[model samples]
Target: MNPKISDFGLARTFGGNQIESNTNRVVGTYGYMAPEYAGNGIFSIKSDVYSFGVLVLEIVSGEKNRGFVHEEHSNNLIGHAWELQNEGRSMELVAKCLGESINVSQVLRSIHVGLLCVQRHPEDRPTMPSVIMMLGGEGPLPSPKEPGFYVGNSTQGFYDGSYGISSNSEPSITKLNGT
Candidate 1:
């Protein structure tokens, strides 16, 4: 797969064991952002992992992570997937178009791995290498913890009243001057 990543306007580079990078201004797409990065201006390798998990879910479900809505449950795609997984019904999250053409076991395993990457706490998320192993079925997969940004039933404002509207648009790119 020829994957191309763009929009590095808010990106930064870090060296050594300095995974955590503090910032006075945070800017990025909402749905794909890790909770720690969004809630506080803390960026790290784990944060990118969280975004990867969201992307995985979106690909599997053929849905957007941020603006997803269901009549039965008011959850974003991640939250909905987590709920289905907890109930041992994760297969339900698979896109209908993929019906019967895909391997069930592989899809389920992928869902598991995706959930692992999006755990609420960064420490709970597996590293990129570990994620690869899990995807390859090289080892036992651990149970996933709760996912980040799992908004449920509450219309609570997120991040200074900049929640709903922006989440529904194209990937947000915000530039803030660091003090």
Candidate 2:
């Protein structure tokens, strides 16, 4: 089943021409929250874009960014996808379960658009319109910049509990790795 989100606990109404706002209650899913909104409670239309990017990445990889773990690196799902893309191995980011039925170009385009939406700077993220066009093959997409809240380092070993602290009210996610 695909991600079916039914609620946003922190959504606020925007008035005419209003595109941004601030909140004191800083509430959102940790892995899906934009850095600015999570850090300073500053949310804008771009924040929703950031959340969409995270959701897309989750859908593509069949992995949750919050509980993701890799033996060769300390990066989360986002960092892992970013690394794979930079190395020209973006196909590796696709969920293995997709098998041969997957459309290569569509998967690549979705990943590209996801990364673009998660760009560190809100200004760098494409508006909803631009994202739709790019996904629909209206034009070539630009290269994406580094994503926010990404933690990456090369260290091959077991996760010793020094990392992986969640910041949201969502239930704790458990990742079971099999050898």
Candidate 3:
């Protein structure tokens, strides 16, 4: 079920030595959109990397990010994936459909490669060429950093619910247990 890259709607040619253009027409999938493109209408090869990362995550988890759920977290699939990777138990996040025959090493590699693509710093991500090399086992993968939009921040915004007002607030101030 491989998609022909040439058939992708967004694919285009820039011609030799031509400058790129900008437009206000922002179009792309929601969860897969790169931060820069989503925020500022800027697109680049790195934007593709971001989308690829999201795709990889979706594939590995067999979950549509549009309705992803974590029963015990404030984060989405990407954030949950990050947490699992950090805890060194990333395979726990794999889709159940993979069953027993799936190679643990291969799954880990794919997750690592996916995480590398979705690094918060666009510059930290591997280029398509480098990604191919890494995927093909011809090159060593660089360490990945925290991903974009992680939910580790202790601060959060809450709705006051008084007169339809909302306010920003930090973690609740409370004493230790039994207080």
| Candidate order (TM-score) | 1, 2, 3
| Candidate 1 ranges with C-alpha deviation above 4 Å | 1-12, 152-179
> Model 3, range 1-179, lDDT digits (tens) per residue?
12223112232433323223333555665566555555445555666777788788889989865456688876667778888998998998899998997988878888899899877667787776667677778456677887765565413222111111121212122212222
Candidate ordering by lDDT (highest first): 1, 2, 3
| Residues forming the 10-long window of minimal summed lDDT in candidate 3 | 158-167
Summarize candidate 1's per-residue lDDT along 67-129 as a digit string, tens digits.
Answer: 788889667889899999999999999999997799888889899999999888889998776
Worst 10 residues of 2 by lDDT: 1-10
Give lDDT per model, in order: 0.74, 0.73, 0.63
Which pairs of residues collide in candidate 2? none
Model 3 gets an lDDT of 0.63
Best by TM-score: 1
TM-scores across all candidates?
A: 0.79, 0.78, 0.74
Candidate 3 or 1, higher TM-score: 1
Residue-level lDDT of model 2, residues 1-179, one tens digit each, is 11113122233354435567777666566677777676566778788888888898999998888778899887777778888889999899899999999989999999999999888788999876677788898468899988776665423221223333344432333333336
